[model samples]
Structures are given as C-alpha cells and as structure tokens.
Target: MSATICAFILTFSTLCGSRVVSGVLSAPTNVSLTSYNMNLVLRWGPPEGATQDLVYTTEYKTSVTNYNVGCVDIITLECDFTSLSVSMHPPIIEYGTYTGRVRAQLGSASSAWVESEQIILDRDTIIGSPRVSLLSNGAAIYVSIVDPVFVISTLRNTYAFATYSITYWNGSQKEKARHINNTQQNHVILKDLEPWTEYCVQVQINVDRNPNPGQLSETVCESTTSVEEAPWVPLMVTIFFVALAVTLVAVTVVYRKSISHFLCPKDALPQHFKENLLKPPNSTIYLDSHPPVEKWHEVQIIADTRTVEEEGPSGGSKDCLQRTA
Candidate 1:
C-alpha cells in the first residue's frame, strides 16, 4: 500500500512541471505594424527562446466605434488585414485619432495586445488640370477647371473656390493678372505683348480658404506673337537696282565717243582741211654761177633794144670805134 501511494505522487508532480514549460515557450514579443492601407499588417518575434514557429493577429477601432474589429488568424509572424476592406470606409470623420492593436499567437495560445500610435486622415479639394491665360493687356487669364463640378462644388464657398491669379515671367521680371470668380472658360489672350519675346504662366488656386495655400497645380507656358519685318525693304532694293542700271548705260555712251576720237583722228577732222593737208608742194632750183657780161649784152641786144640801138646804131658804132681807136 505504501509503494502505490509514492508512485501516484511522483506522476502528479511531473504533469505539473510539463504544463509550466509549455506556457513559457509559447509567449511573444516585439509586436509591430509593417503596413497600413485599406488593410493592416501585423508582425511579431517568437516568444523568448521559443523552439516552435509562431502566428500573429491584428485589430483596429475608430473614435465612433467602441467594439474592436474581430481578430484574423496569422500563421506567420506577419499578417495582412486588407481583406476587411477598411479603406472603403470613410476616413474617420475626425481629422485624426484612430487606433490599431496586434496579438502574437501559437496554436490555441494568444499574446497580450500591442497597441499602435493614433493617426488621422485630413480632407481637402483635389484640383486637376488648372489652366490659365491672359485675355488682353492687363487682362486676367481665363481659368478652366477640368475636374468635374461636383468635386469642386463642395469648396465653392471655401478658399479653394475663390478667383485665381495668373503669374508669368517676362524676361527679367515677373508679371501677374487676376481672374474673375466662378467663370469656367480657361482661354485668355495677352495683349500689349513685347512684340517678340517669351512668357511663362501659372494659375494660383487658393486652397481651403487659407492665405498660405496647401498645394499647387501643374504650370502651363505660352508666349505672345512675334513682331514682323518692315514691308518696304523689298521695294527699296528694286529701286536701287534700277538706278544702278541707268547710270551704267550713260557711262557706256560717253566712253565710246572718247575711244573714237583717240584711235581715228581723220574721221573726226573737218573735210576741207583734210584734203589740203594731204596735197604735195611744187619743186625749185638755184644756179651756182652767172655767164660773162658779153653773153649778157648779146642777150639784151637781140631783144628789141628800145633806145639808139633800136634805130640803127650808125652813130653809136662810129663813136664806139673812135673810142676804141
């Protein structure tokens, strides 16, 4: 009877020790949220010195709701709760203040809940394709909002719906123009343009009625028409060529006359003077010595001697003979 009692006591003590070891091995630590979107993700490390694999689960709550969303079975340390379609629910109406919790598990056992930091989702108007332009000099750019009216209608009274300002870079300086309120046409023509230069424009939409805006739409760029060349240049060039041709013709006529005078003087001289200048002169001769006086006297006596010689020179011959004797 004593041996049987001792055997029963030893068996009970061994069973109790086994229970304690199993409980310590299944505990968990380092719980965290790896991701959050429509769905949530929870992760945790195995219990300290745990030999077997562990599972995890997550829960969430909003300010309005007190009941925790049901738990999800996570076979691995990491688990996704996206299947719950949390994102589809309107973000907590309150700007912020939502909570989440993660639990670690192994088989039937579960770890204490690990809570997450509270977060909030803010609301604002989403503007898309905001186009602006200048209608004329000092004119505001027409603003066209491509987003549906319903999306922007909510903010009509809000600062987001107010008139927009058009700002542009003009070479060295910045220029701005104001847009009319509530008009939807985006086409604007810039007048008094600098004739030939570039301009870049952007529309400023006031968000949430805040003096300091929250976000900016994409910027659009355009420029005014360039100045054109003067119309008289072609006509001026044609007149210049015509004058040049006339001058060339006058010069050619004068040059031809000068050349004829130099090369053929006879053609240029008077007709009477030309004939006389071409005729030859008559010839003339000179005697070297005169014949004796007797030759000269006989020549004179033969011709009709007019004085005593012509009457019959009787007295003249006698007188000449006495003088000779």
Candidate 2:
C-alpha cells in the first residue's frame, strides 16, 4: 500500500513539472546579421503569439570567444554590435568572424536562444562611397577627398593602406574618360586639362588586401578657370573708371554757374525801358493862316502923230523930242 502511494505521488509531481516546462515563452524567429559601411547589426522577429510586453536579450560572440551579453531586457527588435561593449571580451576586430543570438523573456520564464548566421567583418562588410570635391586652378583642377563615415571606426583606421581610384571625363564626352588609379594622396591635382571646360570626377576606395573596391561617389563636375589675363589689365580698367568719375565731378563743381546760366537765360532790358521805346512821341506843331494886302502903281502914256505935212527939215527929231517931253 505504501509503494502504491509513493508511485502515485511521483506521477503527480512529474505531470506538474511537465506542465510548468511547457508553459515557458517561445523563442525568437528569423534571426539575421547585416553589415553596411562597416557597421554590423543583428535583427530578429518576435516569437509566435508574442505580445508587446515581451522583453528580449541579445548576445554576440566571436569564433574563438565565449558568448558575451550585448543587450539586456530590451524591448527593441534589433541590436547594433558595431559599438557594443563587453567586459569579458575585447572590441570587435574588422577581420574576425562574429555570431549573434537572441531570446525572448516574460517575467521569470525565458525562451530558447535563436542563433544568426556567421559573418566575416571585413569581407562581408559593404564599403560606402567616398566624397569628392573639385576646385579650379587656372587650367588644372585640385581634387579633394573625404573618406566615408563608419559606425565605430573610421575607414582609414580600418584600412590603413587603402588608396583612391579616380575617374574623370569631359562633361560632353563621357566615352573619353581618364583614370588615375592607386593614388595615396588625399589632395591631388589633375594637370594639363582644358581651360574653361567642364569636367566630371568620381572617386572610390581601394584596399590592398580586399579584392573589391568601394562604391564610386556621386559624380562631381567643375570647370577649370578661364585663360589667365595680364595682371595689369584689371588695374588699368579700375584706374580709368575712377579717374573718369573724379574728372566729371570736378567739372560739375567748377562750371556750375555757367552751365545754369546757359540753361536758363534772363531778359536783357528792364520793363520800363521796353515800355518807353514802344510809346509814341508827345510834341505837336500846327500851321498858321495869313491875309494878303492890295498895292497899286501909276504909269504915263504919250502918243505922237507923224507930221509929214507939218514938219519940214529938222522937224523929225524936234517934233519927236518935244512931243515925248
């Protein structure tokens, strides 16, 4: 009877333990790893029938190292391992292979871990394009480069021996592109270029060990400066305009009165002089009337009759004289 009782108690306890173990939370699903511009991120989907209140924990490890906790009791669905700190492990190396895992947790119960595919940091990482800037210097262009940004370490720090590959072409003729490969200088000068013409340039990073190069930057175009003029040309033009302006101002100030008089002339004579000259003469004279007096004069008359019968020898002179007297 005691043995039967002990067997019954053991079966009851086993059933209870099985039911408690089955009640634990479900594991996360579709765990994956992605790298971009040398940044590594781990992402996962929520468990089946999981609620928003469920928290998750993330951990990552290298091939030779033990698992190290990255995120604890977090609600986010993704974790960035680029800058994650672990007390027991060193920082992530660019050439090392890494793996990540995540598990869902609810209260005191936790689900099984979901592991992600392995990734080689340097080989699998995608390199972003560098930035290019151009400046015109006479008939040449000075090219400037800015390395692409990263989440944890810089591009130069990761790839110390990296060089740049530059490709340039005339804006109108893209088929005649020119290349300058494996250049280490950040500031390079493209010499012997056509002046006053537009040219476009693109740049990418090339690592010594890595087989693939980075993506090419956005095409940047700039025109070389125009042909250089004589240094004295601008100076002469400036001086001429200044001298002309000064001479004009001086003339205006000195001859202002003459100019104003010529523009607006005043009347020559006064108002009174004009009126006197236009008036008629005031002096007037009239003719007087006179009467004539009558005057008379007397005259004597004598007549002599010829006396042929009366006068004889001297009678002709004597008779005429006596008769006249």
**Residue-level lDDT tens digits of model 1 in 1-325:** 9999878766754554322333532345676543221134445666554434455566666667653553566566665443455464333332334566766565666666777655432232233335343322222222334321322123343334554454555644554542333333344444455644555566654444333432344565444445443435656998999999988888778787776777876565788788888765443222324543453333444564556653334655555666777
Question: What lDDT score belongs to each candidate, Candidate 1 first?
Answer: 0.49, 0.82
Q: Ten-residue segment with the worst summed lDDT in candidate 2?
A: 283-292
Off by over 4 Å in 1: 1-60, 67-143, 147-166, 171-195, 209-212, 226-325
Query: How much is the lDDT of residue 273 in candidate 2?
Result: 96
Tell me the TM-score of each prediction against the true structure. Answer: 0.32, 0.57
Summarize candidate 2's per-residue lDDT along 1-325 as a digit string, tens digits.
Answer: 9999888876755654422335767788899987877777889999766777789998988899988888889999999876666454468777788999999988888888999999988777878899899877778888999998877578778888889999999999989999999988999989898988999999989886566678999999999876644545766999999999999999989998887888997748988998998776664422223444569889888888766666646656566666777
The backbone clash count of each candidate, in order, is 7, 0
RMSD for each model, in Å, please? 28.2, 23.2
Runs off by more than 4 Å, candidate 2: 1-26, 86-89, 151-153, 228-325
lDDT of 2: 0.82
